[model samples]
Target: MTTAARYATFGVREAHGVSPAYERLALAVAQDDEVLALLEALPPAKRQPNLLFSVVRLLGGPVEEPAAFHDYVVANWPAIEPEMRTRWTQTNEPGRCAVLLPVLAALPQPLALLEVGASAGLCLYPDRYAYRYGEHLLGAGEPVLDCVATGVPLPDRRPEVVWRAGLDLNPLDVTDPADVAWLDALIWPEHTHRRARLRAAAAMVAADPPLLVRGDVVDDLPALAAQAPADATLVVFHSSVLYLVPEPRRDAFAELVRGLPGHWVANETPEVLGCDGLPEPPSEAQHNVLALDGKPLAWTRGHGQALSWFG
Candidate 1:
């Protein structure tokens, strides 16, 4: 695809669903020749325009106007170069815990939770953060998260996570200043609430961090799942992670989950599992379709900000 076309497609397929500010920025980037050239200069693997955009904003670049944002990108190309090469757009969003709540609520307590592609393992602490879904209010503490729910009933109480561990290609350490800063950089400029929540979640994990193992998800998942307590209900879960897996390996991951002893919860794009009854995602923006044991549950916004439950 042409540069403009690729970026335009990104704007529609990814950014449009994220937020209005992001959609506008992506569309503007799609049209600007200079910016496109700058982005195109990067290696194909490093050509994530959204990450570039988020990095610029994280560095205090102009975000109020598209023209100024474009100028900032051009001017800061030198500084941004290193980040583009080194960083993957790994956003460890804790807000996704809201979507996981309803599913967790339905499961038996004293669960052994294992997350694949668990960036920083923030979602592993679903019980830590407060949640509000319609009239239902759950959890209490400094970092309260809210989600709009429809059709599905809210989880009555947080699942008792007897054992918790995460698997990722590169697991982040909450105690590390640099790792924490990079996570902060990954957040969009407009979402100050999310940034604050990230910091709070990071602090919570720092007090007692979850076990995060670095390895390929498909190869390492079995061993990691084996480590869970045998008596507890083993729940293997992932959100928005499988899309990163290559097409061939995605099926392998699914088969691995199917072979496992317990239930599986996935919040990913519609086509990732190809499961029946999964709802069609919106044409304009990406949505994380939630499923439990291959049954469609709900369709949610990327960050778990909104949900259309199919319960």
Candidate 2:
């Protein structure tokens, strides 16, 4: 696709799959040269759909209209350049807690959870957040998540997460003010609910942080897997993370999981794993396909707002 076409497609997809506010901004950026020029200023490698939106939000630009947003970008170009150069698109969405609740509840209790690509380790504390799936309510805490469920019965009890650790290429510490602020900046502008939840989750994590190690997930899985206690069920998982892994390495990571002694759970694009028995995800929008041990389980919204269980 041409540059304009790519941006347009991104805008439409984000509108359908992400947020309507981002959709407007993306569409505007596609048509306005001045706005598009600001995006072009970033490194080609950094020109992701989320990058532009994240930068604009970080700079406190309005979410609507291309021209005014363009002026803001131009006015703040000097200040924004350094941030764009150093920051990556890393959103620590705790809303995904809702999507993982059912899967965790179904898993063997007292699990030693290992999450690859766990940014800020917000997802590590599934038991710490409350969830509502239809009429059934689970967890009792400050950060409550509501999800729509289908196809399978919601698990009645929370998984006993005995131990949890996370692996990330760049792990953010929830206790660090700057790190936490960046995570907030990555959130889309109109997602006030999400932003609020992120703050609550960060506070919870700050009070009791999980073990987050920085390393290449594929290269470090075996060692980390070994560190998990043998008495507990090792539940290796990841959400929206493998897209960053190159094809060969992703395959290697899958092979490593297959060789491990416990369950492997993943929420990523269906094609990322190239596993069998998984149907093609709906092409209308981006969906995170949830799977366990290579078998497709369900489809979920990007940030876990809803779940359609196939298992």
Candidate 3:
């Protein structure tokens, strides 16, 4: 309820201060009464109101120069009055800047991004847009999410981004406008800014689509890896998903990821999540980087934060 775990739930600080939209919402943690109520009414089971898990339909956003997010919330009263309905909203929408940077850094240029838990593909389309990290700008409209940790420097030279694709145990295909809208529904109506960002991101997907496959991570990741395009840095990644797999299943999934050809990235911890099988993190924090062979690469402050690269 009270800003759970620094930057644990939202990617507000992850993208840095450039996202005027997210910044506004993050700062709104104080001013907005609705958000405060939602937080106060935090679900006892989860401790935090994850706006990403709802199965309901979210109404679309204003086309251009939309009103402030405050306006949108008032209009969607019936769907969101009780507010905690969409518990996993932010969980599925990728905006965590800290965890994404290092994953990108460890890859070879022109790499093929194969995301394992790509919920609504919010981050799958990161490269297609321009970002604002304070004053810096990166990637004009691609699916790569460039994160700027407070103490870390972002890579100026980008890898040759050959292809961006993802596989999810339950993938949300944006090509299906309704699916995209449903994903939007997961956003907390109180946070108008987030809705705006989701809308803009969805529009991009409407243009150029990312390849998404539906399958279980434990059962499907190995096949996904085998079928990945050759010679590309095979970076397999996931966030907040490890906790859901039962421990035995989690171990199996980890083994599958560890044995894969390229690299692996994960942002999760069983101690702090609803995910079933996860163990305590490699460390206390559910954030860090690993080599393709399962060696610890760097200890990041959080995902997308800086890394203490072993190399």
Candidate 4:
């Protein structure tokens, strides 16, 4: 798809209903030839709506008004371009833990989780947070994640996570003010609740950080996986991450992770992992297919707002 079309698609498919501000800005950017031309100068990946908008927000540029946004970008392209090129759309949303909770709880006790694209490793502490699946509640703590779940056996308890680690090309440190600011910037402008949640989850992680490794997901995964205790169930997992990787690398990672012992949970766009036989997502809105051991189990909303079980 063309850069303009990608922006338009993101406005319709992602930002619509989710963030009206982003939707309007994205649609405006799609139509603005001047802005599109400026974006075209960057690499294709760097032209993403999320990356562009986040960079602008991070730099204290305007995003609420399209005319002001365009003027700011044009004037500040030098500053914005470098940030867009270096920084990624690492939306480390801990709410996604709600979608994985049911699967993790069903698995054997004492799981050793190794997240593939663990931005800040905020998700590594699923057991440390509470969950609300409709009226059914599990665990008890701050950052209570609520999800609209169907056909899912609401987990009776949180998974026993004895060992939690993560592998990322660029692992974010929750304690670092700058890293934490980028995380907060990635969130949509309208999501006040999510911003609060990010702060809460950040505090939880900073208090007792997990073992985070800066390495390639495909090449460095096995070494980290080996570090998990032999007695615990080693469950390799990732959410909304693999899509950033090239198709070939994603396939290689999938093949390698499947060969590892214990469960493999993937929550990504169906096309990203090429998980076949997935039922049509319950809604026309985009969703990530939640799969366990390569079996498509449910369709999950991005940022873990809801889940629809295939069973």
Rank by lDDT, highest first. 4, 1, 2, 3
Task: For model 2, state the Cα shift of residue 137 in Å.
Answer: 0.7
RMSD of each: 2.3, 2.3, 8.1, 1.0
Worst 10 residues of 1 by lDDT: 275-284
Candidate 1 differs from the real structure by a C-alpha RMSD in angstroms, to one decimal, of 2.3
lDDT of 4: 0.92
Error of 4 at 188 (Å): 0.4
TM values, all candidates:
0.91, 0.91, 0.61, 0.98
Candidate 1: residue 173 Cα off by (Å): 1.7
Worst 10-residue lDDT window for candidate 3 reads 47-56
Error of 3 at 170 (Å): 2.5
Model 1 spans > 4 angstroms off: 1-3, 13-18, 41-45, 275-285
Tens digit per residue, CA lDDT, model 3, 74-140: 4664665454443333345555533465457546765777787777666664344555454556656
Q: Candidate 2, which ten residues in sequence have the lowest lDDT sum?
A: 275-284
lDDT (10s digit) by residue, model 2, range 1-311:
45566678878765655677778767777787865676677666466667666777766776676667777877887877787777767778888878877777777778999989888999998878888877888779778887877775687777888899999888999889889878988887778888889999999999999999898888887888899999988989998888767789888998889899989999887768675675655456767888889888888877888888776
Off by over 4 Å in 2: 1-3, 33-45, 275-283
Kindly state the number of residue pairs that clash in model 1. Answer: 0
Local lDDT at 18 for model 3: 28
Against the reference, the lDDT scores of all candidates come to: 0.83, 0.80, 0.53, 0.92
Q: Cα deviation of 104 in candidate 1 (Å)?
A: 1.4
With a 3 Å backbone cut-off (N, CA, C), the pairs that clash in candidate 4 are none
Model 4 C-alpha lDDT per residue in residues 125-170, reported as the tens digit of each score: 9899999987898888899998999999887889999999999999
